[model samples]
Target: MKPAPFNYFAPESLKEAITLLERNHGTSKIIAGGQSLLPLMNMRLATPETLIDLRNIDGMKQIREVNGFLEIGAMVTHQRIMTSTLVQEKCPLLAEAAGHIAHRQVRNRGTIGGSVAHADPAAEFPTVVTALDADIKIEGPGGEHWLKPAEFFLGFMMTTLQPTDILTALRVPVSPPRCGWSVQELARKENFFAIAGAVCLLQLSQNRVVDVHLGIMGCSPAPLKPLQAEETIRGQELTDDLLAKVADLISEQVEPESDLHGTKAYRRAMAGVVTKRALKEAHHRASEGRQ
Candidate 1:
């Protein structure tokens, strides 16, 4: 199927894009990579009257360090992130997650902001960002605003962004010393949507967990940080017994729905299993670095 008729605008600058969005308001949609939007549009599920393409907008494709965070422009492609030396050295978790997104063709065309804006529940970037407590930078006619990861995602396929706002960048905190990370999911193919997934981060001190952040995907309306599960591992020595307890806590916190990929019970069971494995792997990585 072909997309519905729409007026296209390719702005040369960020200000012009904002102006176009402000003028069109509800009638317009921002097109970054169109990896997700085009599919929806082709199906007539999203029929915006206008498309404000950001491809020509300069400065939105940059990736650099600002203060203590790694700032990634909204238009930066998943392929860039997957291969970035800066990203790999600073936030290996994000790089790892990016490597797992779809296939090389999709990653080459999919932008970070596009995926976040699309807000797929099982996407890798969103889950990683939420677990890392990253911040989203958005621009509009009034100027810019920042939103915490927790506040950025409003619902499934929804966000806190206003109609006129454009996501400009994402700010992820640089990995601290002794930080460890892991991402695990089940898919029929190498790049298919996860049946159940877990992204875990642990900050350790003298073999004990100092900080814990665990986010789950493929089991909720939005990528979620299970606070109860995180609390279960905080300050504890990561051991087989402790990991088992934390896994049980995670299982109790999430109620996954039955779907075509797997039964609800199966998904729930996998969630616990994967969470434990992710934590264990991350802990081992941290231990190896320390040694």
Candidate 2:
């Protein structure tokens, strides 16, 4: 299948891009890497009267530090993040998770903002950003606005972005001292979508849990942060039994859907298992920080 006839525009500047979007309004769609939208368009699942390509916009492709946070351009590809020296040094968790994306072929062309905008429940970048407590920057006729990951990702393949809005960048807080991060996912095969994935960030103080972020994927409509699990482990020394309890708690709370990849029961159980594994690994890394 091929996409329906549509006018295409490669705008050189963001101001021009948003102007085109506003003029096209309900009949337009934004294209970043075209990794996701192109396929959908080919399938006729998404047919827009106009397609606005953002790749030509100059400032949306760089990664730099600003005001104590790493500001990643929306057009930054997965492979770029995977290899970026700054990303590796400041947010290695994101760097590691980027390697788990579909494949080198896709990573070479898939933009971080595009993936987050695509918002597949099992996607690595969205879950990583959520765990990192990142902020999304968007621009439109109304000028600029920032959204939390929770606020930005409203549902699977859905976001709060208006038709005229462009996702410009992501701002991730630099990982703190003594912070350990890990990604544990259950996938049918390497680079396949995760059946269930857990991204954990653990910060320890004197052998007690100072803070923990548990970002879950493939078990709910949107990426999740299991507050119960975080609350249960905070300010306490991690024990095997306690980890088990936290895992069980997450299993009971996640809402997995029945699907062809696996049964809801299977995904639900795997979600818990990955959560425990991720937390355990994070703890190990944090301990190594002491050495």
Candidate 3:
């Protein structure tokens, strides 16, 4: 189905885009890549009366480092993230996750901010960013502010953004030396949305886990970090038996709903499975002093 009639406004500056959004109020949609918003519009899932495009805005497509963090503009595409040396060096976990998002064509048009704002339960970026404790910046008529991933995501396909707000950038801290990260997912096809996924980051000291972050997707309303599971393995020597126990803890922590892609039970099971695999690989990389 075709999208309903809408007015298109492409602004050349961030301030202009913000003005348009404020003027349109509740009727406007801020579009970056249009990869997600276009599909939703075409399917009648979203029918905004006005579409405000941000592609022409300056400073919205940059990648830079600030205050010891990699600050990525909201307009950065998945393909850019996958290819950027800066992203690869500072946040390799993002590159690994970007490679798993749909296909090349989609990656070329899918913005990191778009995916995070879309907040799809099965999306990889949100899961990875949340696990990394990344910060999101937003601007509106009221001015600008920053939010942690948990504060930004409210529920499935929902965020804390206001009607006149635009996501400005994402700030991710560089991983420490010897830190290990892995992203694993189960999908029906090579590029389809994951049925279940896990992102794990670990720092091991003398074979004992010192710091760890765990995030799971496709098994909850939003990407979730099972604190119980993290605590289970943190500061402890990882073993098959221990991982199995942590897997069980993760399975019990998630609250997934049944759908055509997979049953709740299936998603829960796979969440644990992927988490175990991710943790194992992360442990290995940490042991090898690689990130």
Alpha-carbon shift of residue 181 in model 1 (angstroms): 1.3
Where does candidate 1 stray beyond 4 Å?
A: none
- Candidate 3: misplaced stretches above 4 Å? none
Comparing 1 and 2 on TM-score, the stronger one = 2
lDDT of 1 by residue, 47-105 (tens): 99999999998898988988989999999999999999999888888988999999999
CA RMSD of all predictions: 1.4, 1.4, 1.0
Worst 10 residues of 1 by lDDT: 282-291
lDDT of 3 at 41: 97
Q: After superposition, how far is residue 227 of candidate 1 from its true place, in Å?
A: 1.7
Candidate 1: residue pairs that collide: none
lDDT of 2 by residue, 143-230 (tens): 9999999888888888888988999999988888778889898988998999999998899999999999889999988898888889
Ranking by lDDT: 2, 3, 1
| Deviation of model 1 at 109, angstroms | 0.8
Candidate with maximal TM-score: 3
